[model samples]
Target: MANIEFFDRTMLEAMSLLAESRRYLTDKAEAESQKMDLEQGLANSMETMRLVARLTQVLAWLLTHRAVHAGEMSIAEATVPDRRLGGRDLCAKDSSDAAKTLPDELQSLLSRSHSLYLRIARLDDQATARAEINTKVSGGPRPQ
Candidate 1:
């Protein structure tokens, strides 16, 4: 199906991005931050962690669906909302002037992660709504 193709392609891109971001955080970003003074370095470090956290949550959601596509996870098992985004409280960085001067790489990665998270959240919402509708149409118990 076309959606299966979409799923495969999305997973490939997401996983590739995960690897690239992990490498940057562990190697490049760390070293680059060390060049800053203490307070600025700590702020950079916090932003780095936030970016990584967002990416990790997105990866978890992607991997869960990958398992479903592989027939290793039931649709019901995958529908749990808590499992979707790990229930992480999103605290997006401020939009003030101080925030505008972040490194280009961090800005790019942060923007990408935000986009991916929103996309996944929308897909999850659509899937859940579809499941509820299917259940209703089939005279099965409606989703609670």
Candidate 2:
């Protein structure tokens, strides 16, 4: 009878510890997931910035080339035929039209990138806090 009681108490203690460990692991996994999401968001924002930079460079080059050609043609008394470059017609009535539109679009994208970065930072903090809690619960064993 005494042996049976001791065995039952030991089983109960083991079950409790198992449950605690499971809960800790679950929380740690969730934190890691959040961290991954934040990292992905940051990566996406960086890619967008790169794309915008490339677009701006292309536009500047096109505008500079057009202005230089126009100047040269005017001096030579020759007509510069309107031609399309990179799918956009350079002789469009509104040469500055696209330029005007781009600033607003770029501004909006930058704002969104800033917001995403802030969210990522917050998530990183949350992940760190969760990891610390997990470590404390596990009695100094690092949370994998």
Candidate 3:
């Protein structure tokens, strides 16, 4: 299905970006972190956490959708609050001023992860809306 293809593409992109971010964070960023002043170092650490959180949320949502597509999870199950896209308060928060001074690679990772999370959040909202509409139309789930 067209929607499946979209998710597949998105999943691949997220995976690629996540891997790149990990490499940069574990290698270059870790080394550069020691060179920063206390304030900047704290900012870098916080931003790094934000970046990881964004990607983790994105990946989790994508995997849930993937499970639904694979028939491993019902649409209703995936729409549940616990399974839905989360971390909006933190993941969607704007980067701090001090974060702007972080390494170029880290800044780029934060930007990319934020953008990806926003896109996936939109998808989650759309999917949940559609599920609600279907439930309304069918007058709730039938016996299974």
Best lDDT among the predictions, by candidate number = 3
Order of models, best lDDT first: 3, 1, 2
Ranking of all predicted structures according to TM-score, beginning with the best and ending with the worst: 3, 1, 2
Q: Name model 1 segments beyond 4 Å from true.
A: 91-99, 138-144
Rate residue 4 of model 3 by lDDT. 83
**Model 1 per-residue lDDT tens digits across residues 86-107:** 5346524332244355677776
RMSD of each: 2.9, 31.4, 2.3
For model 2, residues 2-46, the per-residue Cα lDDT tens digits are 734543453354344335434543554345334445655454444
Q: What TM-score fits each model?
A: 0.79, 0.29, 0.92
Candidate 2 — which residues are off by over 4 angstroms?
1-102
Candidate 3, pairs of clashing residues: none
Q: Better model by TM-score, 1 or 3?
A: 3
Across residues 1-144, which tens digit of lDDT does each residue of candidate 3 receive?
898888888999999999999799877987899999999998988998899899999999999999989999877778888888999999988784556789988888888888889898898998888777778897987223
